[model samples]
Target chain A: MPRRTCGNRAMIWALRLGLMAGVVLLWEWWAPGGLLPTPGQVWHAGIGLAAEGRLWRAVGDSLSIYVAGMASAALVGIPLGLAMGSFRLFGRVVDVFVFALAATPRVAFIPLIIVLLGLGFQAKTFIVFLGAVMPVVLNTYAGVLAADRDLIEMARSTGAGRGRIWRHVVLPGALPFLATGLRLGATIGLINTVVAELYTAVRGLGGLLAIYGNTFRMAEYFVIVAMLATIGVIVTEAMRAVEAHLSRWREER
Target chain B: MTHIRIEGLGHAFGAVTALDGLDLTVRRGEFLVLLGPSGCGKTTLLRMIAGLLEPKAGRVLVDGHRPEPGHDTAMVFQNYRLIPWKTARQNVEFARPGTDVSGYLEMVGLSRFADAFPGALSGGMRQRVALARALAAEAPILLMDEPFASLDAQTRELMQGELRRLIATRPSTVVFVTHGVDEALALADRIVLMSPRPGRIAEEVRPGPGMREYLWQRLREMVLNDPGSDFYGREG
Candidate 1:
């Protein structure tokens, strides 16, 4: 069993390296076939965009909407989750509504969001927030509910006040779940941002892909697809790093 | 003033009566162990004395007053209740967060693992951290619920030594709970054994000098076929 587990780990590493190599090889092949943009052409485009400062501008615009939408979701969702989790009454009152939100396909609301928010940045932000809120709320509530009863009693027995008990015992216990929710929420938020840009004809990688699709420029569309994939990977990796750091600290005590 | 007293103590969960009409007394600076089988209300009694549970019928008094929430009380739990996020020093520091942290760490011989978290440490090491936390609490009365029960025999012996050393340094009136007769004999000044269900004080045994070697023979006769003495209902 141990040897097989070791072999499995080795296979995973090999597969990851092979996947990276295969993507580069296929990109080179398909670029010539007029379905993929060459590395050279993308680099040239990157440099030109940098010179005009449009690359940074594009990044800033997307991030501004992303951060705003995420913040709004967190402000509303986390507090609601905490309230729902901390009190039996609140949990009973809102559990059905929260479940409804979780089960709803957020993309289904894009058309309704457009009608309300119009084809502007507000519409994009609205969609992003819609995708981001549920995970945070659900995870926070579950984490609070699942915290160990003995730990809470231990804190209380030690002359700790109610506030201190909540801070020391409850908050730390719920952290792992909250971290999980935030990471997943961020990914969903990013997808919604790009989708909103695509549907509304705004200036984003998604919009750029849409323009390319209209002109039969499959290589450019493929380039935007690559960028979106990279963004997803980067965001997920960042969240994973944060989670690892917290776990390392948590495990040591 | 009596340091600990239980009067007409009664508690029940649904139809099951865990503790009933139990009256007890613990003097200051005495090591007393409550020994009983599983589901015998040993832990429930300890928790009530520690002010974790409210009595359904009567009252528990610690230091001449009713056991109150957040009093001068410290319990070294069987589960080691060490915060998972904290380092060894951090866990001890949690007991006295505003004081000098290094002193408690040094006292527990955990100065090296001040930054090491609970998951990285062995069970014995984690229990040591928990002991340090209880000591740092500076409570006059300490309550321990089978704190050494989970450890291996060797580790349990060393922990017993560590606990004895701490008891010598700082004399705190403690109520210790366990199922092991040897453990109750080794560390306790007074060993109070309870009946099976609706636990009551069945017998109180005091083993004098050469206690460990002597009680081994006496307790053998009282026990059922040298049954394995596992404090928390697990096999030793």
Candidate 2:
């Protein structure tokens, strides 16, 4: 049975790699004048950017802004979410405002943010923060609310203090939900990083995209887009790994 | 002496009364079982004693003071509410932090599976972890609401015997609630039967040595055909 599973896994990998290669080959043959650049040319552009050290700088700038926004969101969102989830009175008071903020189109705030913070890292970070914080807050709140009451009661029965109950019961129970929120926030933060840079700044990957597009550097543009996509994939995969590690106890393995 | 005293205890959810005007006294280190049919307030009574539910009209006193949840009392629930994120050892250790959990896990025959999480354990095994956790806390009053009700017959019987032995070794004021007559007979020094909705005590019996057969028949009669029982009241 193990041998068969191993074989099946290998076959699945083979198919996935073959499909990706096939797409790149098809794109290469389609047209040289087309909007999309070929995978090989995109790869060549990535190497050229790397040689000039522009690729590293752009990547660094984007990541720093993204991380700053995401970290601040986590700092604000997690505790607020826990408070709102665990206490009915607090939840009632805060829910309306949180929902209103979450419902507004975050992209629409870019102009306002630029006006307030100017075309600096602060504006980009604020835009990303607005885009990302809502999901983390909402999901964390829902997770805390949805935690099994029986478990909470059990913890209470064990002479656990309020803090202990939150640590041992509420936090662990909400981990999967928190992971989902973080993954979503990371993705949205990426998008906002690009959007904020597009609207205001001339640094980061988004800025690079603008420069390449205006200069008709299609290969370079595609490379930057590819890099953004790769970052998104890597961040999501990392979040998933954390989720699995934390939730291993809950899953029937 | 009395470890827990319920005086004119009453509880209602909105318009539906679950328990009303009930009073009971549990002696220190005695295995007092609350035996009744469904909706007879057995659970409500247990919850009140555990300080998890507030009585609408009455009060529960633990050691002559109002009950304090997680301090004077520990409870094992029917659902075996173990923390899914913690292993068997951690669940037990949670009850009494900074204490070695192996002793409790060993007592429950779960020492070997101490590292296993609730999700990985069988229903009976999870219940054992819950039991071990409750035991480790060393609460003066132990309240259980049909803690083994979800187990299969063999496992239920096994758990019943295990619980009896565990309590015997470290006797506490135990108030166990169950619908299973055999279970009560097997575990209780005294049994209190309750009436249906708006539940009140109907009968109390002490099971003496070699009286299992007779007591079983008598309890069956009380459960199924009593004139003033909830059985007739619901039917009427």
Candidate 3:
């Protein structure tokens, strides 16, 4: 069984690589004399940028902003969601505001945010926070609201206090939701980070993309885009690992 | 010797009355079972006694005072309702901090599975954990709401026997609710048969000493004829 599973996995990888090669070959053939650069040229451009240390520096800058924004979102969103879910009156009162913020297009607010916070780390962080916070808040709220009432009643019958019930039952029950929120937040946060740099900042992967595209450095621009995609993939994979570790006790249906 | 007293206890959900005119007194160290068919409000009465619900009218007193959940009462639910994330040991510990959880697990024959989570255990094992947690709570008053109802027949019999033995070792004021006539006969010192809808005591039977068979026949008649089947047609 193990051998067959391994063979299947290898087959999947081979198919994926073959598809990528086919796409790259097609693009290469199509881009010979056009404005678009070939895959080989993109790979070499990536190597050249890496050698110059610009790629690494840009990565570092973008990562810092991304981390900051995500951290702030979690800090703010989780508690808000928990409180909103646990207290009915609180939830009702806050529902309108949360809905308004979530429904508003994040991009439309960028100019306003820039006018208020300026083109600095704070502005970039705010943009990412806006992009990330909605999913985190909504998922956490739903998780808390969706907690098994029977379990809470059982806990109470066992002499557990309100705090103990929340800790033992509500929090652990909400973990799957929390993991989902983090994964989504990571993806959107990365997008916001790139947008922030592209629109306002002088450094980061988004800034590099903007500069390269404007100068018709097609190969380098593709590399930056690939790097952004890689970040999203890495974040999602990491979140999935955390989710699996935390929720190992669940019996899959 | 009365441990629990219910005086004209009544409750309703909107227009549908769940329980009404309940009056009873449970003696200390007695195993009292509330026996009724489905929707007869046996569970509702048990919940009220456990302070999980407030009576729309009347009152319940335990030890001459209003009962409180997690203070003097511990409940075992039909669904087990163990925390899905915590291990059996952790669940028991959460019931009453600073208690010997392993000892409680051992009592329920779950010491081997103490580290297992609820999702990993079979239905019977999860119920055992719930029992252990209830025992660990060290409550003088025990309320059970059809605790073994969801177990398979074989496991249900095993659990019934196990519960009987456990109670024999440590006597408490136990109010067990169940729809199973046999279950009541096996575990109850006194069984209170309830009428359907707006539940009230239809008949109270004491299957003393070697009267299990006779008591079962009598209680089954009451369960089927009195108010339940008459209202719901022989489905009782």
Candidate 4:
């Protein structure tokens, strides 16, 4: 069984690599007079940026903002959401406003954020936070609401106090939901980081995209886009790893 | 000695009355079963005894004081209600922290699966963990609300026998609620039959040679006459 699973995994990897190679070859062939950069051109552009140390700086800048924004969102959103779920009166009172804000497009607030915080790291981080927080809050709230009532009653019957019940049953039960929220929050935060860099200040990978696009550096533009995609994959994969760790008990094996 | 006393116990869920003007006394070391059809307030009464629910119109006293869970009683739920994230051993340990739980897990015959989470266990195994947890608490009263009802027939019978053996050794005052007549006959020292909705004590009998048939007939009659009973269209 183990050997069969290993062979299956190898086959899947082979298929993935073949598909990627096919896509790159197609893109190379379809490139029409600078309309798009060839894969080789994009690779060369990426190497040039790396040699100049600009790629590292942009990655560092973007990642720092993403991390800061995500941390803040988790800090504020998780507790608030849990409180909303735990306290009936508080939840009823605040849910309308929360849902309303979540419904509103976060991009609309960029202008107001710029007016208040200006084109700085704070502004960029706040923008990411705004994009990321709603998902975390909403998912956490839903998770708490979905927590099993029977488990709560069982804990109560075992003489667990409110705090103990929250710790042992409620929090652990909602972990899968919390993990989902964090994963969503991380993805949105990365998007908001790019948006912040593009709209607010010309910095990070987003700044590189704007510069390359404006200068008609199609190869460099493609490189930055690829870098952004790579960052996105890394962030999402990291979130997934964390989620799996948190919910290990959910799986039988 | 009276271990538990419920006097004029009445409760309602919004507009729906669950239990009304109910009175009962449980003796120490006695295995008493509350047998009733669905929506007959057996679970409601058990929860009240477990101190997870408060009566709206009356009171429950354990040893001459208000009943408090973990102090007077430990409950085994119909759904098992074992914490899915906790291992069987950890779940048993949770009943009373800082105590060795191996003995309780062993008693339930789950020592080998101690590290397995509730999700990994079968329904019977999960309930065993719940039973272990309740047992570990060492509370003087054990209140079970159809603890084996979710299990298959064979497993239910096995669990009933296991429970009887376990109770024989521990000798705690037990109040078990169930709709199964065979289950009551197998485990209870005395069975209290409950009427349909707004449940009241209909009959009390000591289990003997013809008790199962008698109880089945009574349950059938109740189900037939009580149109509003949730047990309608279901076997007694």
What C-alpha lDDT do the candidate models reach, one value each?
0.79, 0.85, 0.86, 0.90
- Order the candidates by lDDT, highest first — what do you get? 4, 3, 2, 1
Residue A36 C-alpha lDDT in model 4: 78
User: Which 10-residue span in candidate 4 chain A carries the lowest summed lDDT?
Assistant: A1-10
RMSD of 2: 3.8
lDDT of 2 by residue, B140-214 (tens): 888888888788888888888898888888768899988776777778889887777668898888877765565
> Residue A222, candidate 3: how far off, in angstroms?
0.8
Candidate 3, TM-score of its B chain: 0.90
Question: What are the RMSD figures for all models against the true structure?
Answer: 4.6, 3.8, 3.4, 2.1
lDDT of 1 at B221: 38
TM-score of chain B of each: 0.88, 0.89, 0.90, 0.97
Which 10 consecutive positions of candidate 1 chain A have the poorest summed lDDT? A244-253
Judged by TM-score relative to the true structure, which candidate is superior, 3 or 4?
Answer: 4
Better of 2 and 4 by DockQ: 4
Specify the highest-DockQ model's number.
Answer: 4
Clashing pairs in 4: none
Clashes found in each candidate (C-alpha, N, C closer than 3 A):
6, 0, 1, 0
- Candidate 1's TM-score reads 0.87
Compared with the true structure, what per-residue lDDT tens digits does model 3 show for residues A142-244? Answer: 8899899999998888767889889888888988998898788888999999989876766799899889989988989999998998889889889987987
TM-score of each: 0.87, 0.90, 0.91, 0.95
Q: Which pairs of residues collide in model 3?
A: A159-B70
Native contacts kept (model 3): 0.77
Q: What are the DockQ scores of the candidates, in order?
A: 0.51, 0.64, 0.59, 0.71
Compose the digit string of candidate 4's lDDT tens values, residues B112-224.
99999888899999999999999999999999988988888888889988998899998799999988888888888999999977889998999999887898899989988
The true-versus-predicted C-alpha distance at residue A101 of model 3, in Å, is 1.0
